[model samples]
Each structure stands twice: as structure tokens, then as C-alpha cells.
Target: MSALERRIEAMRLFGRLVATQEGREYLADNNHKSGQAVVVADYEELIKDVMPRIRSHKPPVTIALLKDDELLMFSIGPTPEAERVSSSAASPESTIGMLYEAACQTSNGSSFHLTSWDRDATAFSMPSVRELLSH
Candidate 1:
């Protein structure tokens, strides 16, 4: 296989892993051990409300993940830029809900269980964690 194909497969595999319980456990362990900020936010209601209005925005909506204080855009998103520290998430159809949907489909109906921290430093709510794991 070609290098590009290999990379693509690797990314797909990474997404698949990240969507699983074992992947989550690994991430949680690394986060705790390294003191990294694994930001989680409650976008359930917020995304639902904003999605209708923002679905048609000029730029596509982008959802990023917080890994060790670095912002990595979801590889499955429209732009799919993974090497960046941060990028614009300007969107209409690019709402967090859309990302969640893609993540869901990618994970074969499993939950993303991951969330992004707000642009500003913010704490994730226990309620959000409960809701995420409960699902």
C-alpha cells in the first residue's frame, strides 16, 4: 500500500480506537499521569439550540479535542487538520452536533465520550461526565 493509504488507515484506526472504552481508559490514564487538561464540555443542549441557526454559516463548523493543552481538530471533521494547535471552527453545518454525529457513525453507534474545553480555561462539569458515561 502507498504511504497516503497507510496514513489514512492509521487515522481511521486511531478514530476507531479513540471511540472505544480501552482507548478512553488509556487517554484518561495518560491525562492523569501527565497532568494534561482533558477538557470536556456539555454541548448537548447548547449544540442542539445553536445547530439550526448555525447550520448554514459560511465556513464549515469545526469541533476540536483538547489534548495536553493543545487543540487538535477532529480528523473526521470537514477541514480535518490534525497538526494544528488551534483553528477556526466557523460553521453552519459544522456544529458540535454534526461532529458528534460523525463521531457516532464512525464509532458504529458508540458514544464519542470526549469533549472540548471552552476557548477560555474552563472546568468540565460532573453532570456532563455523568451524562456522558450514562449513555
Candidate 2:
């Protein structure tokens, strides 16, 4: 697959995962005192191990994953304009954590700040987040 295709696939897998009860529980269990969920996995693990177990795909969404200095962005459907705004501002080192924090703050375990459906009214936003996404 092309890079964009890979990203889309990854996002779809992640969105499905986030929609699961197990996924939400895992995230909640791993959430730090600061409200950031400590989720880390390589691309292969996400695609191979995790994606397979999610039996349902509900509520298509967006997600961002950071590896080293790179930020990978994906959406289940069309890429939303807000996704561009946030991804651009993210510093690779902090993107995942910031996304987790935003998720908690917004009561959205899906990390909607990093990516969400185009029409999602609950998408997270803040000046700092906007700035991080802008970069």
C-alpha cells in the first residue's frame, strides 16, 4: 500500500479498536494521573495483534500515532480539516500524550483531539493544542 493507504488502514484499525469495550477499559486502566493514557505499540503490532481482536467497527474516527520524530495521522473516513490543524502543531515527542490528555479532558476516550469525524461536535480544542497541531 502507498503511505496514505497505510495510514488510512492504520486509522481504521485504531478506530475500531477504540470503539471496543476492551479497548476503552485498557485505555482507562493505563491512564495516568495526568489523564494521559500510556499506550505504545509499533505499527506492526497494532495491525497484526490488536486489530484482529476487535469484532466490530463502529463510529469511524481519527487517530494519531507518534514514533520517534514522526507523526502518523489517519482517519476512518475522509480526513477532517481539524486533523490537519492539530497534526501540524504536534511535537513528535508529545503528540501521543497530549492527545491522551485531550481525550480525557473532553471525556472522549478516542482521543478526538488528534483526529475525529468531520462532524463530531465533541472534538477537543485548546489554544495550546491548536498551536501544537499547527506545527
Instruction: Give lDDT per model, in order.
Output: 0.33, 0.35
RMSD of each: 16.3, 13.4
Task: Please provide, for model 2 over 34-85, each residue's C-alpha lDDT reduced to its tens digit, 9 standing for 90 to 100.
Answer: 2332223333332223222211333233334443333343222223456443
lDDT score, candidate 2, position 115: 20
lDDT (Cα, tens digit) per residue for candidate 1, span 1-135: 443343344344335535777656644543322222222222332444443433343323323333222223322212223433334342333444355444444322212222342221111111012222223
Model 1, CA-based lDDT: 0.33
Candidate 2 residues lying further than 4 Å off, grouped into runs, are: 32-135
Model 1 RMSD in Å is 16.3
70 Cα displacement, candidate 2 (Å): 17
